[model samples]
Target chain A: MVDPKLLNFDTLSVHAGQHPDTDHGARAVPIYQTTSYVFRDVDHAAGLFNLERQGHIYSRISNPTVAALEERLAALEGGVGAIATSSGMSALFLAIATLMSAGDHIVSSSALYGGANNLLATTLPRFGITTTFVNPRDTDGFRAAIRPETRLVYGETLGNPGLEIMDVEAVSAVAHESGVPLMLDNTFATPVLFRPFEWGVDLSYHSITKFIGGHGVAIGGALVDSGRFDWTASGKFPTLTEPYPSYHGLRFAEEFGTQAFLIRARVEGLRDFGAPLAPQNAFYILQGTETLGIRMQRHVANTRAIVEYLSGREEVSWISYPELPDHPDHDRAARLMPDGCGAIFAFGIKGGRQAGRKFIKKLKIFSHLANVGDAKSLVIHPASTTHATMSSEQLEKAGIGEDLIRLSIGLEDPDDLIDDLSSALRASRK
Target chain B: MTELLVRGARVSASCGGREPDPSLPLLVFVHGAALDRTCWQLQSRYFAFRGFSVVAVDLPGHGRSEGPLCASVEEYADWLAELVEAAGYHQAHLVGHSMGALITLEAAARHPGRISSLTLCGGAAAIPVHPGLLSAAQNGDDIAYRLMASWGHSRRSHLGGHPTPGLWMMGGSIRLWERTPPGVLASDLAACDRYRRGREAARQVGCPTLLISGSQDIMTPNRSANPLRNGIKTLAEVTIEDAGHIMIVEQPDRVIDALDGFLTGL
Candidate 1:
């Protein structure tokens, strides 16, 4: 098998997990929509069922299109193998389920996406697994939060809307010292800008909804295993080390080696939960991945221009782009994401809620929608809509204030966008 | 000649009631900002049996009536008058809520010849300016949750711990307010600032007006009702005992009773 780390992302996107199909000579991956794949014989089926063989038996376990996406993602992310999931939340759920069971604990960053934050801080406690949330930038914070039962340390590479860049290497160091793995959500900072594996991350997940699809048409997620973590040696991941009653005593780590985490996630997690991505959605995302390089480059460029434009406006009371010269995280951003910061940033208007409402209403070019990652510009007020369920205290803790307006820059002409925003700002101020 | 349409401007649908009647007296409803003509669903249908034509109009940038959203209540009223004229109604009864009620009063003030009577539900001659709301909106919390928290129900109404759709109403209200074009809200609020449609405009209205207020309405209280009562020389009043600012949804029965009694006198 070819090592993905050796190749460039642009090249890997097109060629990974894809070859000229020998039977049909199909260049494009054909969607194998069938529920089950037939075997050569009863022995072949037995081996497949017994986990002794490596062939597709059930679509729930894996589909050809989903497998292609998995392989392509694994290659792009520099991981040994990957698992595609129904949604981003499901991917996080599966990752937690695969690694930690009852009595286990997780250490995570406090400044997380609201949904993820709620799930970790509030929801997971209901399931008997307590989570210790600390600042991702604190290398010692991760270490201190870890209890004896801590199985993982998790954080997002570039925190959503908050845009706080995590020191992945520092967190990884803390996790490694305690015989644990670091999982990073690389959805915002796609491999195009920053690959987490390069910073010693053991696992990375993506909410393919954002940036990856480049369009907000399909909702999907992926989990990429770095294959560097020795689950058997760590002895912390019992599912990987212990005998499997489901597959007739087949130990995952010993049998599948680097591919153990992904295989188990597919067969045990996805198969039981039935959260596999549809072949059509996988196809849509694949098309989106094809233009990843160009889209991300333009997204950064447009976002920088927008940040600059909004910062200088008299109507804008505050701006929260990390790339701003005086921003506390600018230096950290420079050291971490040297290429450019991600496309999302938040700003406040001078007139407060009324002015903000007027500005959004006056916007002719930008679409007012909850979704992001569309080829078109999108805007939202986090406090009033997405984070409306959270209390003011929760919003403050997450660094989200009511005045904050998030902008997801798209591949539009930056000048036109600036003009539209300028007109709206001028109108709002009056 | 009173015509009603639900999804379009200048046409009237049968006041949607659970009854089978074609010749009901029309209760033409004109909704305020953040709501379409569909807001009269409960009233129109409930009173459809009383031989009433329940019709509602979507003001410009409101429901099906599309345009650059109006900047002021006067502009919305002006548009409502034109819609009434277009519907070929020489005289029709009117009911409005909040900003819609403000616009309805403005419409009655502008085109008295086209209106038979008016019902202002949870309305006032003036809206008090909230600095925190304007500040928060200007600063981009256009969703206006804090504003909703302050302006929605009276403190007593919200003492219950159960979550209700009223929360979504606050969210919806903010979204609707925020999603307008720039200067639109400023213009609307500015219109409110410039409005002096108290006893004077009501007196000039030259038609019977009914003022229905929610007891718990923070936006418009019984004190504000003094303006409508003093203005419309021919005016009646009904206070929804325990309702909120959005009395139509909060106290539908009281609203209907007020409208029923007021309309019957005609």
Candidate 2:
């Protein structure tokens, strides 16, 4: 069903989520900053409350702007449905809460984001749910970690900072054998680069704070269900098949069909947590999403240029960008992220930590900041900054060496960036 | 107000600066020869927000610190070590721009135990003493300003691209080189001339180091950076393509990138 003339990323990005408003003639999705929607009468309220009709009840449960974002993200990721949340962490929490309960377990990747790592490693244990972290690329490790009580096998499509590419199909095979759905965090890769659902993942999540927003102006997250996992057939997901007393004995799988997991996450998780995305933030993210395809294209191109420049420099000790010919993951990055691996990468300084600090002091164009995925170029020393809280063992496991520097390539002319780096290196050496 | 005497001058003891997050590392900024501690205004604020304990000091004779300009780089390194120790940063991310870069390298070499990382900006291992420039300064032809103006910027740079000059004076001590004493200026330049830390010192630095230079830096030209660059066993270099020597003023963004990459990696 692919139309050769119509199939392009740019076209999809702009038109994917657009639809005309039937009543108000509003071209743009209006920010429905509403708390509760009034029902026509007692009978209408009863029908809505009893799951007899589809309508918004409260902003915490759903909103027009957020719904548009959810629909757009779901379409972008080719998922059946999506749920928006206050932050990426909240999206993860909702995803896990919807599928598992006390005594359930998860097998996750060791290279997850710091916040996600903390959640899975420390926080989830309090609720009697535990997670086993394995090497991201080790399919056998995932299989070994899964127990009968394991509800999901999770990994980031491209792990945070480390940029390890997970073999989705391999991991999914191990998960399916245990009747556990494979959940993937598509945050770093975004749907534009790698859609995990197409690679056998049953669910996907995004921390829209990074590349998805592009501008670094808003914070939001989303959970998208692929609708391929059969909860009734699995039997392990009793939460979807059994009657839920919270929603008037409604069985999600029986009632929602392909949208069971997503609906459950929204109605059960977001409804209870009250971690709904603000209408303003949702609108901002939607704006960013519209130009994502092009932004990512430039980001990748710029990244490749910087990586090549840094690799050739005599003062640079090492470069960890996967696109480089010398990189260990060069073949894998090319296969999975052929357009480009990403705009971000890690490189070690020749002078180690001291030279790193010097080089940073001399840079003229690149901004030293914690946030990534801005329209501008960014840099940070992970060992002394973001990963300072992590122990040396933890840092090494994440591939964050003391001398490693992370650079997020922006859309500027690559020559300018290279020149800036070249000058910074020259100044640093003195 | 306990003032520690260094080189027979009273300098404010490095007081614990702000909120202390035990996990976060400490950063000590050493200003260039002409500029005082306040040259690091934007950096101090930015790094502090990111959760680092930042301490910047007025070099001798430049700000409130008491001392005469001594024609020796060793004394400068000694003073820097004193400041680092006083700040309670036994080991720190030492960020040195231009003249500060030379001081930072020497200090790291003399007291290797105190520096966790080194960032050198617009600096050189050996600054060739220009005969004409040296004569001009000795003759009181106001050569320091002319040389500084050249080193401080590229012809294409505009003040609008930079944050206000007032931002450069946020810290308690700041004196744009134009206002600094003539003897102090001469002594600073003489100290740079005598300053020969060489490849051995760069090799001796035990921690990670980053080398940053400006493409248009005529003061410490790109070619002169080899000694420091080649000496270091491990180094990463970031060159600001369009920027000149005065990187802190000209291209704060690129400087920020190098800082972010180096700091985060650490």
Q: Please tell me which predicted candidate would have the highest lDDT against the true structure.
A: 2
User: For candidate 2, what is the DockQ?
Assistant: 0.00
Per-candidate TM equals 0.60, 0.60
Model 1: DockQ score: 0.00
lDDT (tens digit, per residue) of candidate 2 on A1-430: 1111222355545544444565887767677788888987875465445543345788888777777777667657766567788988899999899989999999998887778888888899999999988988788999999999999999887776767877778899999999999998887777888877768898888988788888888989988877778786789998898878886565666444355677677777877877999989988988888899989988988887788788788898888777777776678777777777778788888888988898888888899988678788989998888777777888788778878888888888999999999998887687
Q: Global lDDT for candidate 2?
A: 0.73
lDDT computed for candidate 1: 0.71
* Per-residue accuracy of model 2 over B1-266 as CA lDDT, tens digit each: 12446656776322122343446787877777666654554455456556687665667776456766545777777778877666555677888887788888887888888888899888788665566655555665554455555445754342111222101110101115544666666667777777777556777777788888888888788888888778776678999976777776566656766887898897
Q: Least accurate stretch of 10 residues (summed lDDT) in model 1 chain B?
A: B159-168
Question: Would candidate 1 be rated incorrect, acceptable, medium or high by CAPRI criteria?
Answer: incorrect
For each candidate, the alpha-carbon lDDT, in order, equals 0.71, 0.73
